[model samples]
Structures are given as C-alpha cells and as structure tokens.
Target chain A: MIRSEQIEPCAAAEHSGAWARRHVLDIEDFSVPEIELVMQTTSAMKEILSRPLKKVPALRGKTVVTLFYEASTRTRGSFEMAAKHLSADVVNMTAQASSVTKGESLINTLNTIEAIGADIIIMRHPLSGAHYCAAPHVKANLVNAGDGWHAHPTQALLDLYTILNRKGRIAGLKVVIVGDVKHSRVAHSNIWCLTKMGANVVVCGPPTLLPEGLKTAQLLFPGIGVETNIEKAVKDADVVMELRLQKERMQSGLLPGLRDFIAGYQLDSKRLALTKPDSIVMHPGPVNEDVELAADVLHGGRSVVNDQVTNGVAVRMAILYLLAGSREQ
Target chain B: MPSKVVITSDEMRRSIARMAHEIVERNKSTENLLLVGMRTRGVPLAKRLAANIATFEKIPVTVGALDFTLYRDDLNQRQPSVKGTDIPGTIDGKAVVLVDDVLFTGRSARAAMDALIDLGRPEVIQLAVLVDRGHRELPIRADYVGKNIPSSKDEDVQVKLAETDGMDEVRVASQE
Candidate 1:
C-alpha cells in the first residue's frame, strides 16, 4: 500500500525543474529509493486501475508519444493503454508508418517529435543505446521502452511489482531465472533490479547462451549464483522466471535445436516441483508453447504470467505519472 | 515548548459518539450512507464514526479511504506516497461523508471533494472534522466539527487514536 500524498506534486511544480532525473533511460541509472518509489507508486496506481471507471486525471493535458521502430504487440499496446488510462493524450508511432520507413535518422525523428510538442517519448529501437544516443538530441523526457537487447525497464518494474505483491517482500527471495540469458533484455533488467533489491538472482542456461558478463554478476552481488544445471538452480527457489527463447539464437548456433533446448530446459510440471511448494512461475511472454515451458505448467495455478501483463499497465502508469510530473516542471 | 491536551480520551470518545448520532439524525435514514476518510489520521476516525453509528442505528455503514495526492494543488511543495484508495461500493446516489483529523486551510477537504466527484456522482458530499482550526485558505467549511479551537498559525493540532497511534487524545502543540 502506498500513500499518493508521499509524492510531492506541489514540490515538483514549485521549482521550475525540480525532478532528480529528466528521463527514464535505464534501470542501471536508478537508485534503490527511486526503484522503491516506482514500486510503491505502482501499488497505488493498481488500485486506481481496479476502479469501475479505470481512468485518472494525473496526466491530464500531458502528451506521451510511444515510438516503436521494432515490431511488438504487448509492450506497445500496454504502453498506449497505460498512457491513455492516465488521461494523457497518446500518439502511437511505428517505424513502418512513420518517416523512419523512408530512411529518416533516429535522432531526427525524435527531434521532430519534440518539435511537435510531445512531452515525453517512449521509444523501442533495434539498436542498443538507442535511448542513450537520442537523449542528448531531444528536449522531451525519453523513456527507453525496449532498446535492442539493452533494457526493457518497465517490464522489469512490472515483474518486480508482481513478485512483491505475491511474495510480500523482495529481500532474501531466491529467484531462479532460466532460459536464453545471453540476449534477453528482460533477463538483463531483472538481474539489475532483483540484485539491487536484495534478492538472490540465479541465471541458468546452456554455457553458450549464458552471457560472458553474467559470470561477473557475483562480483557486484555476492549472493548472485550462476548454474548450468536447471535442477540445482531451481532447488528451494521462491520464484522461477522462464525467459523466452529466440529462434535467432538457434540460427546463430548458440543452441543446437528446439528439441534439444526443450529437452534440457523446458519448465514442465515435473521441473516445477523441484522448487518450493508455493513457488510461482513467470514468463516474459509471447511464450513459445512447449519450447520455453510446457503448456500445462504455463497455464497452471502457479503461473503469474497474466498478472505480469495486467501489472504492466499499472507499472507503466507509475513511470509515466512520475516522468510526466517532472516534465511539466 | 510543552504540548497541552485539548481533548482527553473520554472527551474524544463522547465527541465521536455525538457526531455519529448527529449524522444519523441529519441523514434521516441510515440507507446509502458512505463514510470516506482522508488518508493517514482521517481513516481511523471515519472507522470509529462508522462503528459508533452502526452501534446506535443497528444498521450497516460502509467505510472507505480516499487518497487525494493526485487531486492536491500543493504537490510541488510536498512529496506524498503511501497507501492506495479503496471505495467499498458505488458512490452514486449515496451520501458521502468525508472525514479528517483537523481542518485548517480546507485544502484537503477540497481535494477530497475533487476525488469523490471523479469516482461517481454522489447525492450529497459533506465534510466532518474532529477538530476545526480556523484559517481556511479555500472557500470551504466543515459541516460537522467535534471542537472548534481558535489558534494562531504557530500552533499545530494533533489527534492520536488507539487504532493507529496506540492512544486516543487530541493535543495542540506549538510549532516553535
């Protein structure tokens, strides 16, 4: 439970530019209090979302532009709905329909959006650091929706919020993340957020799919555990987050075949029993049925994948509300 | 430097009991009565009032909590964050009684009214404060006041309830 009064909207407006950060570029840039603020604020937003008329005037007169240069369904749709729910005027822009299809540069299009009076820009691009590169060239508050394999911060926030709501706490929880750990921006962001929040994060995958930098995760967090054995990784865990396997990883030779990946790492009912009895299962979906997880386990009582999606709106609303307040100042 | 007790425990109880009876008398019938408290201190007071009313009228009364952070006009000066807003049922055609600890500038009551209107159109919205300290900055006044204490800007009125703060008392302390 969060008191909306804890956020000083008046204090924010008193100073012309009072917010600590102008943009939400990465989870790596956020401190513990900032993350907690987002999580706490999200709880309040979730309450508002549950109302019969699920809309708030928090972002009234504010404009949020979601610009996607990549193909997506859930993320784009959720961002649009979250912004609209907050009463912010939203403009959805995809690469195919926008000037980017005609070879317009990323920075140029972003600047044009700023010139068009977009108070904030939510961007998803193919190249990593797309948000980082575009931040300097625009005045609008830049939110990195999902930039290549770099970060999907709002997704991570929702995942954290979901876990917090279910578990009642994040500290000291054993969260075993299993799948293509190498290229998953979801995994990367989760690792940063979980470890920062004091959760014991264990990343498990084939040695090839495990990113080389993941080994150093323990350097930053002594409790961070990396395992190649799925059974060992999930044993006594409080949560098991299964990552989506990209077909591109197989084409790039990181995995042998879909059959081999399923044989080695598929989260079926049998594998779920290895974790704690009350352990919840999660997947950053567009789930590959029978690939990342068995269909039964995915739809089972222990699954919170749908809750993750439902929470996505609340989490994004918190981000937009916080950023929109700052951008107004 | 020392604080003075304005309303003792027994007196606080009697005041709330009286307010409950007054609420029932004015509304004519207990039907469709919803008590909504402003967050922090106001919540327990509203619950107390609801409990007192239920005891007297032998009827059910709905109690809810409203967080007016989004509706506040002074967000730039104070950072607010706490619990979520929970309304028990539809407020349409129901008489909503907004409750709080102390009424000062009347800004909080104003904000609560704004939030209540957004939820649904109520038959009538009324303000009830445990203590009313005169210095209203807005064109708003409380309909029900337990006690009206004339005080300067240099004094603060604080209410403590056993449910939230482990005691039941009201005190006026000097700001300095």
Candidate 2:
C-alpha cells in the first residue's frame, strides 16, 4: 500500500516550452512513456494546486474550449477549473447552445473552433467516436473529455492517479470495475490503463451489460477476464470502481429495471464487504441512488468518488501543463 | 560534509573483486546464490558482480533487480508519487545479497527487505554497498561495504557508472 506521509510533492517535469503538441483522447492505448509523462506532470500539478494562490502560467495566453454535447457537471466544471487555474481562457460549447443544436454537424463546429485560433478543445459527446470523427477536422489539439461509451481517457487517468496515490504502485494490483461494464467509458478506459500498468483487471456487471467480443482490452492484454459475479469479481480487489449507469442503459433494453440493477450491481456496504479490507471505492458520479452505489458507501471512508472529482482538476492540469510547455521528447 | 575523495571506478573494480573473492571463499561455491540489486545503481553492480563470479568459477550466476518504492514507509513522510517494485527473477530458497549505492537513511534498505519477503523467503541474506555513509536510523548494517565514509546528514551522494550514466563519479552535493 502507498504511504501518504511526508511526501514532498514531485515538481512538474521541466517544461522547456517545447511540449505544446500532445493530445489525449483515450487512456486505453497510451504508451508507457505517455502515461508516465502524464503521471509525472500530474504530480507537479497536484503540488501546485496545494498552494493558496493556486493558478499557474503554464497554460496562460491559450484558448481551451470545452465542447460537451452530453450532460456532465463534474467533468465540465473540472476542465473549466483546471484551465482557469492554469490561467488559460475557456470557451464552453454544449449542444444546447452551439450551432450543433441547429444541425450544424460535428465537423462544421469543430472546424469553426479550429478557425477561431482555438489552442485546445476538450469535448464530451454522446455519439460514439464523435471525437475521433472530429479529430482530423479540428486544427487545435483535441482532448476527449468523454466520448460516448467508447472511452473517457481523462477519467481513467484520474482514477489511476487515485490508485497510485493511495496504493503507491500500479504493478500486480487487482482492480475490479463494477456495474454497467458494456456502456461505461470509465470501465473501458480503465481496462487499458490498469492493464498497461501491469495491474490485473476484472470487469464485472450484469450479463446484459457485460458482453463478450471486447477486442481492445484483449488486444492490449490477452489474459484479461470478463466476469459477471460481483462477489467473485471483487474478491481480493485492491481498487473497485463503480460506474454510474447512464439513463440510456434502460432505453437500450439492457437493464430490466432499477430495482433489479441495484440488487445485482449496486456497491452498498454489503457488496463493498466482498472487497479487500484496505480497498477503496470509486465512482464517476451522479450515482444512481441505489443502483450503482449506495448513499452511505459514497460518503463513507472507502469512497474516493469525491477524491476522483478533485483529482480530475489535478490530472487535467497536468495534461494541459505538459502539453503547453514542451513537445520534445 | 567531509570532502571524501571517494573510490574511483578502478578502485570500485578492485573492491568488487575483493568482495567477490570473499563471497566465493565463504560459500565455497556459487550454488543457491543469487545477487539482487536494489534499483537504479545496485542493478548494474549486481550484473558486474555476477559477471566477475562467472569468470572466476566458470559457472553461471543468476542476477535480479528489486525496487523498494512499494515497500517504503517514508513515502507518506516525503512525496506522494508512484514508484513501482519490479522483481524480474524469483528468490526461492536462494542466498541473496541486497546491493545498493549509498546506505544513508537505511529506510530504503529496510523497505528492500520487506519487498524481498513478499517475493519469497531466502535461506540467507546479506548486504553489499558501494558507499556506507553512516547516519543510521535503523539498526541495519552492510555485510560487504566497498567504502565506509562517515558524513553529515545534509550531504547528498550520487553515484554514476559508465554502464548507466556514461561516466563513473560520486558527487556529494549539499541537500537543498
């Protein structure tokens, strides 16, 4: 386990003002260097945030656009706060307000953001691979905040930061991601980050949401297992991440009802009982009352859902700070 | 901090030769023996020791690396970051030597021992160090010490070897 005593926070990697060309869309496929680059940079950003006057000039004089066509308060606000902390200007574009509401197509809006001297665009859209489709069209660096069920790279990164901070190491860890595995971008992104860092992973959910034919997780790690039993999946787990079931899950007919989903997949104190003693509980919130997690568990000692939210600012700060400072290896 | 003109690379080579001779003479053979380096610098030192022993006895030597970051109890005292424990080989019933550069805080040595226990129990264990600047907090002692130069606690000793950082030098900088 990671010891949290007297640790002099690491200084951010010396940004030579040459690191402004990087972009993060998915954590599943990030190389070890890329991951470390983010981790090391995040370490320094965390230290910076600990100060009273928390803002930095690392990302000053740059344009960071938050393009979210999905409902999110934590993710969007964290990005806004992080960019603000780094002294960068922010532009928020949701489908509700943007020309995207008038059928302006993803490409046109992305192109417009590009033409407006936008230095960066942080996006979260409901449509799968929408960011990938807009990646080529946008001239500025694109950060996929949450792109449908495909991947939420930054969320996974923040989750990893939580684990690394609490546990101190990533290798040989047993991480179990529970609930809505099929439609969870957090679970998907975690499969890549945890596996890449040499942690054994198990994705467990109800049979309907946890399907077969996951090629990305398997392609990166051929030995990963996908299970359905919450008990068997979470046994001896060092870290267990519970994902919130999107409202679309029921509309998609994958879940029968909320009562049944909670009975099977909810991580209450009883379900949390099955995990390792020192295990930490995590969630990407707006948690369903009794579906994905219980109220007590979310507020209890093990829950890092709140910490996960706070770390989002730190992680994003690291990403932008690193990308803004140096593009050199 | 004393300006100790620490051992040169040639001096290092001779000390390793002597240490290698002592290890072989005491054990009578390399059987059940393994050299495990304690991270960045000790790893190469173990390789060199293994190489020297192989040359002396015409028998193969098993070399492994043990990173102590995970086992450290001082992380909470210092900095919160991820430093992993990577053990590339097994340590079942073997005689092990924990190799390191500077044995100052002794916390790192203590952590290395804890990490080794998780890997497997060794029949016998010993310590080897390139430098042992005595400001011991724990009751640990190095079994094989290349150089024992006493120094103040504020001094930082960095060892660079040609195999790793393209040069062999020991610099003692004042702690910031």
Candidate 3:
C-alpha cells in the first residue's frame, strides 16, 4: 500500500483549479499558482516513487509517444520511465531510426502518431520553436523536452524542485547560471522559471558566449543581471548552476579556447568559496568533467545533480498526469 | 429535500469507544494489530479508535492513512485527484482493520483492499465502518458496524467529523 503520513484532506481541493493548459511548451507563460500546483503534484508523485511498488494506475491505458529529433539520454529515458510508472503504453521514436531519416515531414509523422491513437506526444527537436509547428498539427497533448535554445521546461522544473528541496524556497535567493548561456536551452528555461518565482538571477559567461540581446532583455524582465567576470557573478550566490559547454562553440570562435574558458569560468573550489556556505551546486548532467565544473564539485555532498535526475521523472509524471487529465475539466 | 441529523457528537464518541472494545475482544489483544483508515474522515476516526484502545488496553496501536484514489473504478467517468497513502511500517504478518466513515456501495472498500494488498500480505484483513447503510453492490460486509441505517436509494448519508468539518455528526438528506 502506498501511504503518506501527512495527508492534507483539502490538498486536492486546493489544486482543483490549478491546471487547465492543454500543452506544456514553455515556462515563460506559467503563472505562479500553476508552478506551485506542479510542485505540489510532484511532491505527491515523489511519495509514489518512494514506495516499493512504484506504479500508479493514474494514466492506465493511455498511450504516450516520445518523438525525438535530437539525441538525448536522460530526458528521453526519464519521460519513458515516468509514462511506464504511471502504467501508460509508451512508444519511443528517434530521428535516426524513424521515418525522419527518410525525409518524412514532421507534420506527417505527427499525424501518423495521432492516427495510431497517441494520447500524448513528447518531442525534442534540434530547432527552436519546433513545438509551435507540431502543436497545431495534432490534437494530442505536446510536451517540449528541449528545442534548440528555446526552452527545456521539465529540466528547469526539476532544477526548481531540487533547489526548493534544498533551500526551502526560491524567492530572494541569488542564482548564478554559469557557462554558454546563449546556446543552452536549460539556461534559458531556468532564467524564466527562476525570475518568475522571484529569484535574483545572474547569468555569467564570456561576452561572446552570452546572448546578444541580454542587456536589452533585462529591460523587459528586470532583476536579471548579466556579468562577464566569474568572480563577481559568484559573490553571495545561493545556487550555482553549470551548463554543459558545447565544444562546437570553440570551433565557431565564440570561445577563445577550452583552457581559457575553464581557467576563467570553471566552478572550482576557489569560485565556490565566493557563494554562501549552504549554497548548492547544480548541473544538468553529461558534465564535461573539468570544462564547466570541477569533478569534485560535481560529485560533492552539496551537488544535487543526481537528485535532479531522480526528480526529473517525478516532475514529468506530474506534468503528464495534469495534461492527460485536463480533458476531464 | 429535508436533512436530519442521524448521529450526534456524543453518540459518535460512545460508538467509537464500543468499536474499540469490540476490536480488542475480537483480536484478543492489540499486539501486531494495525488500523488503516480511509482518507478524509476515516483518518481521524482511526486515530480516535487508537486512543480509545490505548486508554483501555494501555497498548498503543499503529495507524495509517490510505488514499486509494488511483485504484478507484470511476477513473474513466471522472478524474479524481490523489490524496496519497501513508503507512508507517511494514504490514506483513499483521492483523489489519480497515476503517471508514460510511459504507454504501462497497466499491471503495474493495479498492482499498486492492491498494492494501499491493504493499504486502497482511495476516488477516477485517472491515470496520461507523455506519453500514444498505445497498452494497459487492459481496462485502463489515466485521464491526456501528450502526446500520436503511433508507431509500435517493437519500445520501453524509458523515462529517470535527477534524475536517466544524462539527461531528452524521446526517441523511435527499439527493438534490
């Protein structure tokens, strides 16, 4: 029996009006209450995950298909696990093996999946705004896993869950995102989610690696700080999130060199000392060993990188549960 | 449609005390006994019963809250939110007594059993309900029933507890 020691009788009643969105494309338009509702549902899903029998019949008989146009390991695996844990039938398709290699259009593939009775489609593409093109082509619910540098909402949500689990809150905390912010979908999504939740967000990277319109974008969404100096960005920081630096940036001349980038911006012991004592270290995995973050920091006690992966499944479960059941409203 | 109070606060307390004594008499002692309550009102009732058993037998009993929303049969008809199930420890080889406020359809009791069996094997599983109103759709009968209220199918039996609602009472009203 799956049991919770603290069962709030009015918890379900409180979140009755919390979810109505048919698709989860981005966190830029999510209200605070909606985010809180997702966190609340994630907490409940976490309890289910803790049980010996980590299976729930909430999405039983529902068909969930994961359509990936980009190569992925954690996101695709966790989405598949989340669907399977909820007792849903899952079908996974990759661009390399699927009809995409045969030049089948994205719309035709979506229509084929819909015709095969897919209740939900989770897609990750290499192009930005891929979900917008796919959303209108099918009535099935669409979840954006990661689309170029546009948004990775589930990754941001699990990061938020990890930060909240560690720090107990998101507001009034200094969160410094380190690495190639211009090319990281994780960084973009976290910027929106953290700022919307009242966190003081500061993006730290080399001038060439930072987005071009960041200074002007700050005018639209205030309290977002952009700093080129790593030392100044880590000062009094509460959360230091390291994004994976793509090696292609060096070839593109956006970064001078890997050695220069690491010496200037790597989150090592020296830079970590600048943050608060209780501050946490985070990285959306596939860490580059020593490029963006030190190996010690990635495996240290303060690092919640593994917990973020574990929470990723629960967060996706909550999102799938909410979106699949939204039709009942 | 008119509503009338069927069980008052004082009667609720007395009925709970009697049920506790009956449970102890049937099980012979409170040893290795677990009290699992359905969500909403059954949680407080189980706590109250544990307190009563502790007062009489001087032995504390384990209580758990069971929320079987996922195991419910009406998933396709309506989307019910999950309230979560919480058990303190293992239920293996223990005599479990499932508690609920009112028993009408017997479907919830069946779902609760399915949810319980998924965790572990209990030595013996028994049902204890405060009010066992007639019209059971399944072949399930309570081991200890506080009161049996027989009424028309259109009438609704509402059980409100002070832990949840502002008062403790059982009311019967015509369905609107």
Best by TM-score: 3
For model 2, state the Cα shift of residue A263 in Å: 1.6
lDDT per residue as tens, model 3, A101-206:
8999999999999899999999999999989888877889999999988999999999998888788789999999999999999999999999998999999999
The CAPRI class of candidate 1 is acceptable
* Native-to-model Cα distance after best TM-score fit, residue B151 in candidate 1, in Å: 5.6
Using DockQ as the measure, which candidate wins?
3
Task: List each candidate's DockQ score.
Answer: 0.28, 0.02, 0.48
- The Cα error of candidate 2 at residue A204, in Å, is 0.9
Where does candidate 3 stray beyond 4 Å? A1-13
True contacts kept of each: 0.27, 0.00, 0.43
Supply the DockQ value of model 2: 0.02
Residues B69-155 of candidate 1 have per-residue lDDT tens digits of: 777776545445635687776889999999999999988888889888878889999899999999999999988999998889989
1 against 2, candidate with superior TM-score? 1
* C-alpha lDDT values of all predictions: 0.85, 0.76, 0.88
Better of 1 and 3 by DockQ: 3
Candidate 2 docking classification = incorrect
